[model samples]
Target: MTSTLTAPVQPETVHAIEVGVMQDRIIPEPVGPPSYRASYVTRDTAPGKARRGVVLALKTWGLEQLADTAELLVSELVTNTFVHTDSRTVGVVVTRTAETTVRIMVLDTDRAEMSVPTCPSGDEESGRGLFLVAALADRWDIERVSTGKRIWCELDTKKVQP
Candidate 1:
């Protein structure tokens, strides 16, 4: 596993930053409060920094644990886009519910059905991205968009601070 460090900000300070970020950033209008979004394009290169930034942003919401899990989720999602879908444009959004649950959604161009991450044989080299996401995320699912598809996984921090 890759490693990245996020400067720890106090919960109150992080909460404030989250509010400011949401206020300054453009957000889609949903039924309830608009969710925060972060988008990136995948490539043959790894998506480590992008994943780290995402984890930091969510840290402001006191979802540090969720953010940690999200790093893996986002990495897998972005990596999958590069591996499975030929498209490089990948978008990720972090949506929170009134119940204080956060969902990470990754959008990629290939609407032609997707596959779940299954455990590879012990000696095998790979095929465990989705498996990690499945284990870390509370729940996950996929949806078809007008252009491509969006794969989402929900993480429940269980702490409703923000």
Candidate 2:
């Protein structure tokens, strides 16, 4: 007769987890000095509400030229956060630079690097948001944050040039 023995399973096993930290880097920069500022905080719902709020705020601040572009940019940025990131709080900041420029920033708890917007074959149903941002904004880019990332763009406010 033959007997076989098996080793006991270990009681403790080490587990490895990957943690990511948000880094801040400016995507697009404003052309002039900072002037007006507005911030919006909301849950991970839809981005339309936030976009509308920003549009109104910019309009009030006499940044009408940036209104349409800002709305579209905000929509793209907020949509990206709500769709890609976890269900965490999202915030947006709209800053006026000089008298004819505005900067829109969308902040989220996502640490992944942002890719430039693309629409494959122009027939794709998604991935076109950033394209709109590029067309409307003078310049745009992503900024890494301590806990997430910020998507930003600059637009002409259509204000009287000094």
Task: Name the best candidate (by lDDT).
Answer: 1
Clashing residue pairs, backbone N/CA/C < 3 A, model 1: none
**C-alpha RMSD by candidate, in order:** 12.3, 17.7
Query: Model 2 over residues 105-139: C-alpha lDDT tens digits?
Result: 78777776666555667677887777777877888
Which candidate should be chosen as best, given TM-score against the real structure? 1
Score residue 38 of candidate 2 by CA lDDT.
Answer: 29
Provide TM-scores for the models: 0.70, 0.66
Encode model 1's per-residue lDDT on 84-156: one tens digit a residue.
8876567667777645678778887787776655679999877887887788888998778888998899877
Least accurate 10 contiguous residues by lDDT in model 2: 20-29
lDDT of each: 0.68, 0.64
